[model samples]
Target: MVRYAFSKIGMTSTFTTNGSAQGVTVLKMQPARVLRHETLENGKVVVVVEYDTGHKNKLVRGWVVDNPAEYQVGSPLKAPSLNAGQKLKITGFSKGRGFQDAMTRHGFGGGPASHGSRFHRSPGSVGMRAEPGRVMKGKKMPGQDGNVQVTLRNVQVAYWSTEESVMAIVGGVPGARGGIVFV
Candidate 1:
């Protein structure tokens, strides 16, 4: 079973344990409000929740639950209990690097870097000679990079604090700091 929560990406720091350092990503969880409940045909209960209720823009999400009696409408939703060394899946949008070149975007090797070489960073020879004259579709050219939804699976939980409503996971996560992530 999986539980869902909306959290903001916090500062990334290194944690020391057993004389070794490991990078960890911190998340600040917001208290969610139970909006409604629905019973599916499969005999599972789905709870609709709203996060950041005090803000102008609120986020509403629905998660399946095993028991419907545990949740009450118009009440604060309980935070998911997480333990250290537990695996979690986190989904969020990656950081956006705008309008990058082919070399930076697609890892293309350009021509020689000598002063005389004209092709430094351009994506050379994009079309055919005669047959099917135009460049093929889905060409690796310059375009937008990142800012897309990314899911990281099996991310181990480093620590969790119920009083502070913060969680730290081992390794890096997608999206810029302060961005919202679903766990």
Candidate 2:
């Protein structure tokens, strides 16, 4: 088994034992906070950890239970465990650098909003003359943003007695609601 210690990045808590999970006991989590949890856009029970302090700005770290129980905000949970097939590390996603213009980012032309203002939303100049030479490698134009690798760990697991579900995760799980949560 690939043993992993339970831990929260910014939280002031530590756990020596790693959470374990197995079987179909993984299916009950709501999406919450993510850097790039888009890949898991299915109905996957994923637990996300918010890297940002604003309680909204965040990233997708990982999931909650093997068979996750229905989870909601302010729900109590216990620390979970992952064993063999249960432990899934989230991978693959473009990195986000933050903020991009529409024209260059999405590859579009400018439009005129006002009669006097001609340049409404254009990609503008990609490069200068030969002064800088060859449009400069990786010139700041615009394209793609918000997609990063985020991992959740040592999440406190809570019990859902009403549903007979044992895995309840504390804090926010990455991604939007119904997003897939990798082990």
Candidate 3:
């Protein structure tokens, strides 16, 4: 069974393990209070949890679990017990880069560079003539980039401190530091 918890991304640092230095991302688990519980038709249980974001606002998340009796409404959810080298999947939003160009966003190779071709960083030949008059849907155009949920799988735990509720996972974690992440 998978246990879910809400954590904030901490700093990125290196840790010595097995005589080798490995990059790790630190995460500080937030205290989540159980709001309610619901059971699905498929016998799956979902617990709604509320987390204090430290910004005067609350963040609510629903976690699916194998058993609902383990959680009680209006009480703090138990932190997941994790061990070193345990594989974990972390999900969070990536860093947002607002309003990017086609060359920067979609990695489009424009025409000419030196002799004033006027197509240095523009999206070229977007549509065809009368037959299909307009630009087709789902075209790779420049727009919002990042700020979307990203999940990283198979991230091994580099360190875990149950007392402090801090976890360090091997390798990089998506989103900005101090951002909310689910494990």
Candidate 3: how large is its RMSD?
2.0
Question: Which is superior by lDDT, 1 or 3?
Answer: 1
Comparing 1 and 2 on lDDT, the stronger one:
1
Residue range with the least summed lDDT across 10 consecutive positions in model 2: 1-10
Per-residue alpha-carbon lDDT of candidate 1 for residues 97-133, written as tens digits (9 for 90 to 100): 9999999999998999998989999999899978998
Order of the predicted models by lDDT, top scorer first: 1, 3, 2
Measured against the true structure, the TM-scores of the candidates, in listed sequence, are: 0.84, 0.32, 0.90
Best by TM-score: 3
- Give the alpha carbon lDDT tens digit for every residue of 48-117 in model 3: 8888767688888787887778788998867787899899888889999999988899888878888978
Q: Give the alpha-carbon lDDT of every model.
A: 0.83, 0.42, 0.81
lDDT score at residue 88, model 2, on the 0-100 scale: 42
Clashes of each: 0, 40, 0
Which consecutive 10 residues in model 1 have the weakest lDDT in total?
1-10
Clashes of 2: 40
Q: lDDT per residue, candidate 2, 1-183, as tens digits? A: 111222222212222236544112222433333322222456655544442222454443555334443433334333344332232443223345467786646667687787887687866677778786567787656666656656766544433332432233444545443344443
Q: Which stretches of candidate 1 lie over 4 Å from their true place?
A: 1-3, 12-17, 38-46, 53-55
